[model samples]
Target: MVILLNCAHHLSQRLQTTFVNYGEATMYSLETCPSPWLRSHSVWGRYTVSFLLIITQLGFCSVYFMFMADNLQQIVEEVHVTSNTCQPRKFLVLTPILDIRIYMLTILPFLIMLVFIRNLKVLSVFSTMANITTLGSMILIFEYIIQDIPDPSNLPLMANWKTFLLFFGTAIFTFEGVGMVLPLKNQMKNPQHFPLVLYVGMSLVIFLYSCLGILGYMKFGSDTQASITLNLPNCWLYQSVKLMYSVGIFFTYALQFHVPAEIIIPFAVSQVSQPSSSPAWTWSSP
Candidate 1:
């Protein structure tokens, strides 16, 4: 929360400075900044930010793939475990398709297609839907956590330095919304209200992250998977929740991919001859 507020304050300052210096408020993406480093005018800065953004987006995509695959695997495995008549089959049957890698591949093309949608305006609707589904998933997760309260004595209050480092990294990654702040603020109909929006939105984000992190660790202890959704009970409702959350993450992948795609695609297009041959290339062409 503090980090969010700090970022918001910094962004607010930057926006104000830009308005004062330029004599008008205008949308400014990271690459449009006056600073050579931020705007990527320098070779080092351009490559560094480009690599980091692409790597980060790829990391997010891989995580989403794993998340959906794991949940789907769990759903299928649980179904078989609970059902008496279900038998393991060979020779490339429907059961074989339940494999995690299969699930990952099944959803991969859809994600690729989604990334083709370069327009933020069109993607915003899906982003809103993703937020809604994510919220619903969180509520369901909270219900599950509260229903099975763990004894506090069994949970550790502190961890070793190594574990603390892990926690720190995780927390940083969880709250890494600073990069999105400027673009989001720029897109606002009334950019002046962005500070208020940031405060309210990030407050909720912090609250949710804190509640989920603390309660999830408390509930699952050492048995927790990378995602709390994997630890959910083997029930139809919980299974549905996992599916819903996967869909949300799937939608979110486009948003994450948008950043690096926008950064790299234009540059790539400008280098290529006859970029207008491809629709995506034309759309991204400088």
Candidate 2:
């Protein structure tokens, strides 16, 4: 961005200088030059470009889920004493799909509307609620999974007190909404609405998670995979649900580092566009 900005600035200056040198001979102004043309061309292009991104992600997700489902029975058959739960691969992968579904269908669309949303305060409240609820869901899931380990097979993995502590401690990965919290916080227009959103979100999260966990526990008991896939006895439902979940997750996690990249890209490009600065490190936004 820095490089682009510098190039824009330099080109603007050069155009003005050229016009002055030409002295009334040139019909075109700097605004009509190639730099401005490019700027105009690309200014609203991100919105359109983002559409293609969603399509590509969805396609990849479909293929991935299909491949996984085809091998799922074989994968399940391979499980032995060492493999107590379906969560090692399936759950880890599926939860992200759930997260992505919430983000794209719910959060992302809502956020995009933030630009033109009339009810800034209300929307902020909603966003805060969403984040808090998301966090609550994470916490509840962690608690349930930790406590509801029905299979004695996993007990050895948590044999020692120190090891037990490590297992629960590392469970933070299940609740990893820290990456999203700050952005939600900053976007809130009414600070007072935050607490309300958090409370509501948490309550919803707890309720949904408890219900889901209970249903899950009841359905599979000892056979419970960390994810829905292993718990699903019906092959068709397993494939369908897994497909949907994987697609959603692929979108959300794939952009986990987007916030930091957003900050870095502009500056890198700006520096590159300058005469004395190093070349910019711009790449296609993934």
Candidate 3:
């Protein structure tokens, strides 16, 4: 995002107006560029990009929801199975059954509350918690992963083209914080340091992700599940890592939810002729 940051900074200085988020930046950039060719369809450019970003962010939130549900469901089921007890089916209203679908239903209320949070400052606390939980889970899993040594020759160096595409897609998905750059920079206390912050944060993420992939593969060879968490030992300690990761993914959902809400809600609010009376835009006088 160094390039994006530099361009945004240049725009901010020249225009003397802060770019709120990607939509606004794209809109303003297209509208005000020197070339008439670029300025021809600024409104369409903004709307098209906004729709694409909305889909992207919402897709991320959907993934997070399923991820948390799947991990939590597995953890719960494992515990119940070890105890030789059936997973109670009637655990609704009071609680949810040990099923991924039910876990999502159970999670929806808290998820709604989390997304309703309008302040980025407050939302950053959840983001920080997510970072902590994710790192903690990774550390815990890595501890288990490094224990079993396997021969390097046991694993294949390359996969078939189809599976290689799967790996490529997953790697790209894992590295998807680029879409948040403009909004995050807008929320920063000092936006000038965003490039440095981006570099450090992304470098750390790449290092951790690479370590997990390489080390986990070296240890497990080809006998891995969709998630590395699933390949962990079926002990209480390892099971707790699943809970930690579910919590991390839950926390991450809010950040992804924020980007789409910023774009869609503003446009929705603007569509109303009398937005002043809308409860979403303001509160009743207290």
Model 3: which residue pairs collide?
Answer: none
- Number of the top-ranking candidate, with lDDT as the measure: 3
Ranked candidates, highest lDDT first: 3, 1, 2
* TM-score (C-alpha) between model 3 and the true structure: 0.87
lDDT of 3 by residue, 1-286 (tens): 5765776777787778766556656777888889798798787877888898888778778878888877767766656434333221222232335556788898899999888877777778998999899889888888877775678786898766778877876876774566778878877779888888888988888888888888888887777666887777666676778899899888877777877887777677667677566665642101
User: What is residue 2's positional error in candidate 1, in angstroms?
Assistant: 11
- Each candidate structure's count of clashing pairs: 0, 15, 0
For 176-220, candidate 1 gives per-residue lDDT tens digits of: 445455556556677668778877987888888888888888887
List per-prediction Cα lDDT, in the order shown.
Answer: 0.65, 0.41, 0.75
Find the candidate with the highest TM-score and give its number. 3
Tens digits of per-residue lDDT for model 2 on 84-198?
A: 3333333333222233333335434433443233333444454455455445434444444454445544333223475576546435433444333333433445533655676
Rank ordering of all candidates by TM-score, starting from the highest: 3, 1, 2
Better of 1 and 3 by lDDT: 3
